[model samples]
Target chain A: MKVTKKTKVIRSPKRGFYDKETIYKILDNHFICQIAFVYEGYPVIIPTIYGRDNNNLYIHGATVSRMLLELEKGVPLSINITQTDGIVLARSAFHHSLNYQSVTIFGEATLVTSENERYKALKIISDQIIPFRWEEVRLPSKKELKATKILKIPIVEASAKIRKEPPSDEKEDYNLSIWAGEIPITSTIQNPISDPKLKEGIPIPESVKKLMKKE
Target chain B: MKVTKKTKVIRSPKRGFYDKETIYKILDNHFICQIAFVYEGYPVIIPTIYGRDNNNLYIHGATVSRMLLELEKGVPLSINITQTDGIVLARSAFHHSLNYQSVTIFGEATLVTSENERYKALKIISDQIIPFRWEEVRLPSKKELKATKILKIPIVEASAKIRKEPPSDEKEDYNLSIWAGEIPITSTIQNPISDPKLKEGIPIPESVKKLMKKE
Candidate 1:
């Protein structure tokens, strides 16, 4: 990953990471991302699902979606994926902070035009959400595929910013008789709730079972 | 909560909401937000913590932070807050989706100048993270307050988009022998870990105790 002027972590340079391994590790942990693009000379942001392959990130939307339409024009795109790990409590409010891992990517996205590549991108996206479920579910038909538009953004310029340690307070402030600690935050998958219209005899599949076990 | 052209939910119009009660309910649940601003004709996004009052949202950073500096110039700012409730599983890959609640605010922010208002905004932000924490910890001093910059954006042209129901698949696809359900996702606060350098006799504060009980 090339750390261009835009991708460099100007503030708190110590927390910035410009390697592909760190960037991909953070991106692979979360499926949802907030994408920012220029529309009508104003910046617009939208939250959507994304999947990252080797060097490219894929996002899909309906053919008539405004975000996809604007992004397909090869406009500059900024994608952010963040995960809040914990809340850092300090003896002083000025020193409080959060332990989070975030990656920001600055690049342009082009519409995926090839049929074979589109299918591959869609599969990568599905696998990001739930692995091994694509083989169990009914694949998208030609008409369905045509209704969806997929865009690929190369991860050429990106950087990850992370803070994982405890709170750092001023030297004398720590002596104050104030309670200070860390509250860990976690997002876990609960038990699956079956669909109301599900068939009576169908059991939970292996993919979900594996997810439950892993979580 | 006016539905201007910029705030209108173009795609999936049925999921769009234009009410204060609904939008605030979602905003009050999360403390992190993604903010987008145009820089040198390109959109840049940064993830930061935010707090919301009745009709305004407040975000703070170092006085010299790039995001705060750029936003204080009275440029257009876009803020997005999203919470993923669950993953909607369907019998077909085309119908898979996520149950999420998201709000997008389009407005401009001004640097909060008044000392009292700045203190109030900092208290609100600290409350958003942990209730009653502002009273327990050492309040920001005058010099510390001067080092921080707070910006407030009115929630006038904001809209919330939500999807909370089960998967809606094709009529014929539901009959297939495939598992379909919702995997609920939850962000919970675990037990608090005491600071390594904490005072020997200081017990956990009421704020953290209450947060643990509530969560």
Candidate 2:
């Protein structure tokens, strides 16, 4: 992957990573992403779910959604996936920062037109949200698929920025008797709440059981 | 307070909220935000921390930061703050969704030039990350303040979209014996890890201790 001027991290150059391994690692760990595109000379951002498979990223929304309609026109897009790791507490207010891993991709999305490809893309997105659940649950019917629009963006130009270390305070500020450290933050999955209309004897599915075990 | 065309939520109209109370509640709970701005005819998105005070949202960066420099030009900007509450697992893949609260603000940001306002904005940002830590930590000095730039965007044109209920499966799919529910997700603050160079006798600060207590 080439580091284009747009994908390069201008601030904190040292934290910028251009390698595919680093970019994919951050993208695969998070499901939500914010995509930016120019609309009528103004920038617009839409936060939505995304799935990455090999060198392509997929996102699906209702066919009539404004965002999906605009993106399907093959407009230039900037997508960002971020995971906040912790809050860095420094000895001074100026030095406070966050520990995070984020990836930004620059590309244009093309509408997935083929029936087979659309189905595959939808499955990839479903799997990204909950692995193995796509196989367990009912698949999308032709009517449902028709109402959804899927877009695929080639992940050729991307970069990752990461900050994982403890807070670094000014040399003199460290002696100010202030306690400085890192407060780790994590998104944890709690017990599943069954739908009120669920059947009486149905137990938790295997995919959710596996997810709980991982947690 | 007006729902301008830019800030109106076009998708899932029922999920959109225009009330200030709902917007402010979502903004007050989250600090990280993604800001989009048009640069050289292309849209660029940057993820950063922000603080909301009344009708203005403040974000700061190094004086030389590209994002700050570009945004200070008063270009139109779109900022989004999203908090994913859970993953809604439905009986069918097409119905699976995420439970989240997100607020999007469409406006222009101006450079904060006044010395007093700059200092106060920085404190609000710091307090947003960790309350009470601003009082304990060393304040920014003249040079440090000069080295940073802050931009304030009005919160007038904003809307929030939220989804908190359980998954809604199709009428026939609900009887398919598949497990359907929501996996609640929460960003938890873990125990603070003291900096390696911390003084042995210094204890954890009150701000962090209080944050942990709330968790």
Candidate 3:
């Protein structure tokens, strides 16, 4: 999809691109996102977990979710996901910036009503956080399903802004006697703590063991 | 400062805190934030870096920043900062969630015009990314300072929402044959990668060296 005026990057047009492939890559790499919507005439930003399946993005919460209630009114919403790759330290304070990849997805969200679809949407969300963990876990009960709400927003319009290179200092500032470089940053999964109320003989799942090794 | 109705955490009131100390700790620990505003009648979210100084929060960008321009007009804005602490893997998909700490501040913003204040704000912003790097880097030139816009938003109405516990699955599901626990997550400062065009003999600063050892 082309970059719509609504989704265009105005501050740094040179850093913007509207390719869905690039957008998906960034979205798949990050599971948490912030959603923007109007609440009582005030713009509000809320942090929540998300899952991307093909062209649609899913976010779930309790049926009493204020975000779900406000968003399902057919109002416009913007979802933002960002990952910091490195810290770019410039020779001048004015030129310091972060090397990051971010995606802004725009769409109107609709509530998923069908029981089958809600289960699928949540399974996608569960697996998004930890691959194959859903298979080992018990499924939701009927009352639990009734209390959960899943909303789907199609990727109708989206754009990505990326900055991967080192800082670009002035020609003269480069000669200054200062250390300038990027301190690489990445998120890692740390040690897992077993639940205090665990049953008698439940071992950590294989899925979690794999994440430990990978991390 | 007390959290007003504007910043109330309605969804999970038990996890909400309005105390300034808790809010400031969350803000100081995380540097990146997402700002929410209305553009062309549609809600928009943009990710940006921020700094916290006492009871005020600061964000800077190019003078041409649409977010800064719109915010300077005294429009309503929502600034959100979040840190993912762990992942709550529940025995049932419906109860799966993340352990995170997030703060949301709501207020009108004003542009910082004085040179002294702008320099201070940028210095605070720079230090927020990496301590002591600003002192080593050259100060911003007159033109560089002129091209940048810094906005200050008071922490008048703010709240921190946090969840750092293990999964709370259904009572019956706890006895089921599934793994349930908390997988920790944290951001570690990696080794600094010297800029390819760095001068010959600029040793890594003590600031970066400390971070390397600590991480």
Per-model TM-score versus the true fold: 0.99, 0.98, 0.97
Candidates ranked by TM-score, best first? 1, 2, 3
Task: Report the lDDT tens digits of candidate 1 across residue range A22-85.
Answer: 9999999989999999899888999989888999999998999989999999999999988999
Question: Candidate 2, which segments miss by more than 4 Å at Cα?
Answer: none
| Error at A44, model 1, angstroms | 0.4
lDDT of 1: 0.93
User: Worst 10-residue stretch by lDDT in candidate 2 chain A?
Assistant: A3-12
Q: What does fnat come to for each candidate?
A: 0.90, 0.91, 0.92
Give per-residue CA lDDT, model 1, range B159-186, as digits (tens). Answer: 9999999889999998899989899999
- CAPRI band of model 3? high
Candidate 2 residue lDDT tens string, A1-215: 79898887877789999998888888888889999999888899989898889999999999999888899999989998889999999898888999999998888999999999999898899888888999899988989999999999999788999999988998887778889999999999999999999999999999999888978
iRMS values for every prediction: 0.7, 0.8, 1.0
Candidate achieving the largest DockQ: 1
Instruction: Look at candidate 3 and tell me the lDDT of residue A7.
Output: 84
Report the TM-score of the second chain of model 3 against its true counterpart.
0.95
Model 1 ranges with Cα > 4 A deviation? none
Which is superior by DockQ, 1 or 3? 1
CAPRI quality of model 2? high
List RMSD in Å for every model shown.
Answer: 0.8, 1.0, 1.3
